[model samples]
Target: MSSNKLSAVLEKQIHHLCLKDFPCGYGTWRKTKDSTEGAETEDTDDLLDLLSCRHSPWRHDKSWSPQAPALRRLAVLTPERLHTDFIYNYFTTLRIVDKGVSVIDDGLLRFSKLEELVLSDNKITEIPAENLPSTLKILELRANRLSALNSLTNCLPPRLEYLSLGSNSLGSHDDIFHLTGRHWPQLVCLDLSDCEFKDQRALLSALSTLSCLRTLVLEGNPFTLAPSYPGFTVDSVPQLSCLDTSWISAEERQCFRGLAKNSDLIVDRASATVSVGRARGIPDPLMRVEENAPDFPVVNYGYFITYEFLSHQTVNLNFDRESKSDAANVIEDDADLQSNRNCEKESCKQLMVYTEETCHDVTHVSGHSTSKLTWSECMDFSHTHTYIVGDLGGLKRFFNKGLYLTIEEEKVLSWPAASEDVPLAKPSRPVKEKKSRKGEESPIKSGSTKDKSKDKKKKSVPELFQDAPIRRILGSVHIPLHSLVTGGQKVLVLCNVGALQTESEVEATQTLEKDLGKTIKEDKKKDKESKQGGGSSTKQKNTAASKGKVKGGQECKMDVHTDNSVSVQLEPVTVEFNVELEKWQSASEAHQLLLPQHNSLSKQPVLS
Candidate 1:
């Protein structure tokens, strides 16, 4: 209780308390105690100054609590050493307040329940994979220098759904697939857009196989091209159902429509005629023939007629004559005569004539044997010769009647008679003549010769029908059918008929028929083989049944039903031709005939 004694006790108690309170206090006091000489005074002064400042750090003496409340959130602006005791029980949410500040060794063990981690917009070239907590849900690593996605793979929490790895230097679609495949099963949304998926197949494959994926943003990546079909407007994304492309222009749409319109189906007879003309040597003079002869009838032939029957036919004949002698010398002189004879005897003889004046009553006959008519006179003979032998055959038969049985004309000059030479007479003696009286002496007076011999001769007769050009008339006919059935519907039949020109058209027709026949035969052989195989199978089944083997009733019935259904479905429909190409008609008429029926049928309303 005495002043001196109390002061000593207080000093001792203060020393002990200071030692226990701050460990650094003892070190500072010891350092002051150890100071020697002049340094002792300086150290004591620093100690006093620290004590004074500690007593009143603020203007008002406020008590500093020994225990601080646990920091729920702490933002550090500057790099400073944190005392272990200061942050051990405090901070839960720690955020870096300054960018480019590395908090590398900051003890983070206090914040054990940290949920959201965002280290975005920093100079974080790399983040340690193990630093991330499993409790984290949102990890934003956007706008960083993450050249590779491998860094985040192991650190990514299963519950971490929202990950923004955008604006990083991740290279390709494969990298995207590699990154996502690890976490995509649970990923509901993926943003690989603008990643530049230059390889469409890789992108498409990745997109297709992603099971949990729903929203994929793939705009601004090229691979979109025009649609497969013209006028097709629907946008497609392979298996997925969304596409975003630039709007098509009106001109492009119009072009598509024009293509579709022009592609509509058409059928016509002129097509067939053109085909025929090409096969034949017939120069498609018919192309111009229409313009030249506008009055010609136009006719359309339906599918039923063979193109062969639509051509002209001309007859050719060869005549062989036998002579008793070689007489080669006289052959040149007889060239024109032989030509005339051949014309009269061969082709002209085969002309068909119709005396009844009706097409149905037309008949044929020969010309040379019937009369001595020439080519030109044949036309006049019809007018002059009243019996009216219409053709060469009719004329021959008419003239061959008992009343006018004509024989072959015989040659008037024999070769021997023409060869006989007449000898010149011996020079005759000059005969003397006496003049009469002076007035009547004129006969011999001036330039008259005593002996005068004179001679001269000439003669001719015209022939008939000598100069007419040879004319070969060609004809053809076709029959039309009322109806034909195709695709289980009755349709009209059109066909071409009559004899065709035996030249090229006939050859082409023959070739077509032969090809068709070969095809039919091959088909028939195949059908027969199939039928035989079926019969064998049926017989085997019967034999097996007769042998008393157990069989499932319903299975056999099902097989039978299936076979019947297949047979019905596979049955080939037979097509028939009912219309034929008529005589060469104008293009307009052909068009009219072929298109009307098709147009009318197309216009009819369906019963359904």
Candidate 2:
């Protein structure tokens, strides 16, 4: 509508826009004024106008072709003039996100060859299908005002492979009906996360029609809170390789198979088994010899486990008492872990620790001298804890507060030898009689400094192994609860907890360093230009700046050194565990009598 003139905001953002690749062409062409843009797009065979060179308009019929005369002076115009301009037809990809676009106007239809379009984070309420390019293969409209697909689904490109409609208000059952194979037959990956879609049955029934859908994300939907959710979703769409963010495992697929058809078999309080398996590539901390050791050294190292889980507490009331005479004596328990307390403050964030006393010792190949541990034996630590979840909402909360597991390398210096002849002086009097006499004779002197010193020594003497061995925190691994919640069965879940590292984190630090380096250079340039009045002050400032830089570099080096020496150097150890939810019958005898239906569920097909 503005002809060839673009708005001020569009002009500023125009340089960031990119041109799509030609069919069977070399590569994509970027429209940047920088020299690198030409180098980057030089391999392409098609001619591109990076300077927005205007050309005469060509006819849309048989006169326009790839080898048209007007193509020699191709006009790289703004996206708003896409309808009037003929040169933009060469582009196959268009991205106009966060542009405050409220409507899908006729401007986009001009790019007849556009294969991909990203219009996310806009105020688009409805998409007129006629305005879309038929060649579009991927369209991302996430975080938009789209409420329904009735208008858009009618003329959607047949070859559309990927569609992302997340963070929208498409909640109705009719909206789901439009998302079928009949509309987008070739649709492979569909993202419908963070929507208002309710009714698990209706959603699954509608999505089941998309036979080609390989990856489907239905996270943050209202139906996701149902106990039979992911189980039902998985069974409904068996063709999916991924759901939410997790990939479907063979065992998980088998567990939740045929669950959609059987709705009554959904679990309330599910059971799980957690097992800590053997670790590989664990370094022997005692390999480096220390001073003043016994002839034979005793090395002690083991695995420690810690995790946060949800546990339900119930209260019972007495009806015979005068205060509660009106209340009923009989009480019933529900599988749903419903609580009237505030979820923000009381969401069960309890930490459980399996200490050294409970852990089994790791076998050394050649005792303390061994550099590596044997792989055949189990390091020995496993636990099974049951969660009392009423619905998928509780499970979701548990997932948000992920399972925090830390793998610590505990080491002991030495164990005292039995042959060591440590002499102990015999007491002059009976210990109990002496204590009774002292208490009687020195009642007034009980608060004396001498008695206090003696008491302090006595207290400190019993604290064994205080300085014996050093405990180093190797690293921690966060285990996601998605598998636990979505597994949908009371089975032994084996989880491999790998040793954590910092290599993946270096990229962030590197980018930060680059940004800081640019700012430092600019600051130095400004300082040089401003300090023309004095030599002493400038010299002092230079010295101070140099010292600061040196100090910062040293600090950075120390941090990197510590990280490399501790977490990065340690090889990844495989810690396996199984977590199973306990049965409600085992929890209480009264619950067993009340949950008679649970016994019959095993005979039938269970979903959750």
Candidate 3:
């Protein structure tokens, strides 16, 4: 379309020039159509077809039209004019990425020796199989506009070993059949990641035919969300050495074997494994020990995170309303429908009352449990807890409530050091001693000493970090569960922990805010004067006011002084963790139950 052509794009991309001699009679071939008769013939050795030639002893001169050696590889950039007559048959690899090429032209046939062709990130809808070189062994059409392989699969290259069609619009279950060994028998590695394939059983059945398929990727597809995924795929195609990004372990293969046989397998609830891998970014409480308590002698501290979430049984109540009420449940028939209703409408306002009551009841009876895990600053804590969800609707509702995480910080403090340096607790004399002196005046003094020793042991037990006297709540964050249930893929979440403020810190923050407000007002006044009169003097005054405001903000950082102590400024902490939801069943039990039912044929009575 544009004046810029593929030749120009190739000139800039080529790294070096290679020259070689052309085969004899390389350009002598010419088509000869008999005019008198209807027959046509091609002349392969004739040279008289040449219109012009230099003088030579021989009638045919070979030097006049020297055949230029063909390029073995070409990578073009932004090829406005893609097709050309000059692309030769010597090419083995050709790459044209993100060039907006929408069609595969016959010009590609010129590269008879082409083995690999990369046409990723294009606007291509269908790849005409005839346009591709039969010698092509690897083809990558990732991130294209292709939706179906009906056109391409009809005549796939017999030698095609690797094919990448990821990030395309190929969503049809019928398209899965095109990937079987019937099309490309030698296809060993296939990438259909980020595609739209949804039927898990159909996909597995189709891939099972590719006995040579060693590596398969189906991530970002709807079918991958099945609890049986990867395992089901592995079971269906045991020849696969790798699935998605993970290598298939022998133990995993052995565990999930035979689960996908006959394409009728359902996952068992108790066997599903939901794993949450290790986390990063969890702040170490010991890092701030020196700042929080500098005078204390050898303080012992430990940190752990606790997460609270609702079980699947509670959320299932929203969907299985028909089981509880004969009348169709009006309050939450559909999440999308309820979301579309306006809160300002009278009908919606009336519904809210019932919704709140239902939610409250659901919350009360819900299996709310808190699990504590030790924080790992150096590595990941790859531990996970499982929750059973019976159906898709229940799974959706479960995620709507999400998970809550709280970081609890504890410290073991020495009493003598705390009494002398920190004003947390005041020393008190024992009234028991006075009572004992009066009640047991005749008792031996040795017994009193022993009682005192037992009392001291009970007062300080450093091993019990959970019930430690000095406890600090670092922060808490909420993670939505909806993401965990989607795509059946593992995901890492990172959240910043905003530390809670103490009484003294809160007071100081309020003071700083007031000072900032005054400075802001002063800056506004200076800005107004500058806007009114655009002069050098006004500009200088504005700059000086801004500088003064900056200094004021710096000075506003004051120490939080309380009645008897100064509070330490808390730092922001960040935490990272991985979460994954798995179904113990061969496939999610919820999905299996949701399958459509068909009416059975009636049987006619027959004489025995």
Best by TM-score: 3
Better of 1 and 3 by lDDT: 3
- Assess the local accuracy of residue 201 in candidate 2 as a C-alpha lDDT between 0 and 100: 72
Q: What residue runs in model 1 are displaced by over 4 Å at the alpha carbon?
A: 1-98, 101-110, 189-197, 207-608
Q: What are the TM-scores, per candidate, against the unseen true structure?
A: 0.23, 0.39, 0.48
Worst 10 residues of 1 by lDDT: 269-278
Q: If ranked by TM-score, best first, what sequence of candidates would result?
A: 3, 2, 1
List the candidate 2 regions with Cα displacement exceeding 4 Å.
Answer: 1-83, 88-90, 97-106, 109-115, 120-137, 143-161, 166-178, 181-189, 193-200, 211-260, 263-307, 311-383, 401-608
Candidate 1 overall lDDT versus native: 0.31
Question: In model 1, what lDDT does residue 437 have?
Answer: 23
Q: Across residues 71-144, which tens digit of lDDT does each residue of candidate 2 receive? A: 33232323333233444565565566676777676766666887987888877888888888889999899999
TM-score of 3: 0.48
Encode model 3's per-residue lDDT on 1-608: one tens digit a residue.
Answer: 53333333333333222211111122222243433344443343332322223552222322211222123112111122223444455456667777666778776676687798888887788888988889999899999899999999977788999999998988686688787888878999999987777667777778889979999888766555556666678788889999987898988877776667536534222111233334345444333222333332334445555664433222223445566443221221112223323311222222223333243122211322123443344434344444333233333344546666666665554434324322332222222232223454423233466675775644432221223446566678887755543444455677556644443344456876787778778878878878889998878988887888777666654321331132234444556655555543433343343232101101222111
1 or 3, which is superior by TM-score?
Answer: 3
Q: Single out the weakest 10-residue window by summed lDDT for candidate 2.
A: 361-370
Runs in model 3 deviating more than 4 A are 1-87, 245-253, 267-498, 519-568, 571-578, 583-608
